[model samples]
Target: MNRTNSSKSIRLLNYIEEKGNKLPHPVTIFILFTFIVIVLSHILYVMGTSVTFEGVNNETMETEMLTVEAVSLLVPEGIAYMFSNVVSNFTSFVALGPVLVAMLGVGVAEKSGYISALMTNTVTKAPKRFVTPIVVLMGVLSNVAASVGYVVLVPLGAIIFLGFNRHPLAGLSAAFAGVAGGYSANLVLGTNDPLLSGISTEAAKILDAGYVVNPTDNWFYMFASTFLIVILGTLITDKLIEPKLGKFVPTEPMGNQNNEVSAIEKKGLFWANISILLTILAIAILVVPENGPLRGEGGSIITSPFMSSIIFLMMVIFLIPGVVYGVVTKTVKNDKDIANLMTSSLETMAGFIVLIFFAAQFVALFNYTNLGTIIAVKGADLLQAIQLDGVLLLVALIIITTIINIFIAADSAKWAIMAPVFVPMFMQMGIAPEVTQVAYRIGDASTNIVSPLMPFFPLVVAFAQRYGKQNGVGTVISLMLPYSIMFLVCWTIFFVIWYLLGIPVGPGTNLNY
Candidate 1:
């Protein structure tokens, strides 16, 4: 009976995967969406579609009646606007520059062996009983370097478990949970923070033109979530997954695989740590002093240069430690090596750049047509009429995002499409864009483990195959499903409690705008 149910579940997931892959590429979808929006704007304009709401005049600071009407792009003026703004739209995309700048520094750390060494040093040195939590914790932290966790820690987890004579699959599951499932939770800011926040900020401008969603808006919640994930992942592995997987017997000879940190690498890590402390100290000096340059008017830190320069500061934080580690280990011999590493990092962003081109056009046109505002106003009205405000509203967003995530796996792409509508709509219902953004992240991170369409899902399956020839994608999914479900359930509850308690999600951020 159990075998039959498992077979049915696998078949269903396989069907979903098959259909999802058949969908057009995200870039192509955006292009189609842009065309559709153009045609829809014309139709809606002819149909007299518009919405009236009270809005504040930014320049005059006065309350006034605002009517948003659909504007068609088929006219000569519309066509001219589209052609003239194409380059500017892509260049001015809020999510593009910060992510690219941050990635350059991340590339340095990842390429210079700093991130890998740090992950290895932490995981390999832990005691037997504590290794699982340490592995999970490293997985959660490894995301600050972006996608490095997927390639490095996922497989390293299996080796660690095998070394301890435990079920290697369990270790793989635990690590996979942390890397993919805990993706949104990190102790430090990464490329994703700026990317998602930028999108949310643009979305917020549909209603509040001057509103700015900081990259650190969700930092407080995500920082705490890191521990929640570590704890939940650790328990699921030891209590449920390891016991269910039973015992593993190696069929082949285990060869020597050096997983230990070398003496020189340790020395390099020491200097890297010192560099990080120095960086933090330098930043503190600029922000902590009453007359500091980074301090805002009246000694306010929130509205200061330090807050505005977070993206650049994040880059420097990673850049300095990476360079220090590289020089200490001779991995970076000179400025030329550093330049090459930065170039290598940017090369990985080629696909993202292409996607952003079409995405920018779609977002720019969507806003220009006033379709987003119209939709948001009407949608907010509907949600409020149905009493889906406050906690219920957030929970609904989480569930909706979770389902959509199975088909569309890119976080930025999904958020770009959803934010323009949901962020403004939620804001209308007295919810902050920051709260909406975090809810979307919970949904996005939860089902990543079970989503076959996720880019790394196939890679995880391949890793599992190393343990047993019979292991396949189903095995990996089944192993991780527990973690995914638990993360979704417990993480959502944690967020709800945080919201009810009226705790700020980040520095100076509130649940209500």
Candidate 2:
């Protein structure tokens, strides 16, 4: 029986890998999706199908009923939109800017040998037992630093594992799972907290005029989830994902591999630390005053200009340390060397740049057709009439949310569309809005690893290709499947058990209002 079970497990994984690999290239997939969106848009428009829901109006900043009708791309106006918006879409796509800019800094760090030296030192000097857990922990905590996980930590993970003489793809999978799959679960409150909570509050207001949801309302559950993700990511990497990757032999140079830090490298690390400190000090000076340039109106951190420019800040954070390290190690002798390093880094993004162009169009096309919003509205409507109660109802909500998330990649947007319907419906049934929001979060985060529509999905693919040039969408997805399944199952169970015991989901937030 034991052998049979093991065989079945191997078969299941192989099947997943086979199916995933069978799919076309990530860029081709995006192009195909865009084509499908166009056809579906025409069909739905011909049928005169549409869905309207209450959404927070961006211009008015108030809850208003919003209607989305399918648009036929065959129509003149639709064609015009497609043509006119293509450039804008590619230029303004959310993921494109952050990923490219962040990579600019990381590229500098990588090419300058700072990242390699750091990882090598960490591998040799740090205790082996703690390395995997530490990597997972960093990935989880990266949420607080915004999109750092996608552009920075994921690749660094591969490098770190490579330094340890382990399979680099396995490390990449672990970090991606924690960073992307476990995105919604964190030990502390961050920008997303307010974004989702604000939407939940607006939805709750449809039932109660003065309902308010704070950012930290999900802190306790999320704190627990942080540890859960770390443990799960570590285990999945060590026990499952790594074993599947087997042995990897690196094809590229990974800097000085003496396995011992040279005196110059040690000096470089010291200067890098100083550079990081100086960067932080400069940022603090910019944001600490009431009238500072980085402070938002009324001095709110969440709304601050500093928060808005986090990507740029991250670039500085990485670039300074990298240049200092390079100079100290004599790898960078002049300004031309730094410029050449950054240029070399950009060259590596040729494949990624091509991929993002199509991805941008696909995401724009989906939104243009309004299919994502319509589907989410219809899905929420279906769940509302199911008449579930108590823990079962929450489970249903999570499942539905997860399904919707596979299509609608934007967290706040999905919640905005669904919240008006479900939040009010749940409140009418004696459930709290906070509880509903928490459930939606679980579904939202768990599937990020598998969703091709996610803005950063292509970027992760690019990261993976740096190590295993042949690795594709299938490889990354197969690696992350366990983490997704395990996190969703375990997180939902934790929520259900906590609910049964009448535990507060957050501060003064109960299962029911």
Note the Cα lDDT for every prediction shown: 0.90, 0.74
How many angstroms is residue 216 displaced in model 2 relative to the true structure, after the best TM-score fit? Answer: 13
Instruction: Report the C-alpha lDDT of model 1 over 28-105, residue by residue, as the tens digit.
Output: 889999999999988998898999987655676676888788888987878888999999999999999999999988
lDDT of 2 by residue, 1-513 (tens): 012223554456456545554555566656777788899899999999987677655556677787767888989999999999989877864445555676667677778877666655554565777778777777776675456567767877787778778887877887888788788888766546765775676566554556777666788888888888888888888997787777886677656534467889989998998999999999999998888899887876656677667667767788899899999999999999999988987787676567667766775676667665566567556656785666887898899988776666656546755676677667656688999999999999998887766778889888888875776666666677788899899889988988899888786577886
Error of 2 at 474 (Å): 15
**Model 1 misplaced regions, further than 4 Å:** 1-5
- RMSD for all candidates, in order, please: 1.6, 7.9
- Mark the regions of model 2 whose C-alpha exceeds 4 Å error after superposition: 1-6, 56-61, 127-132, 135-226, 232-258, 388-488, 491-513
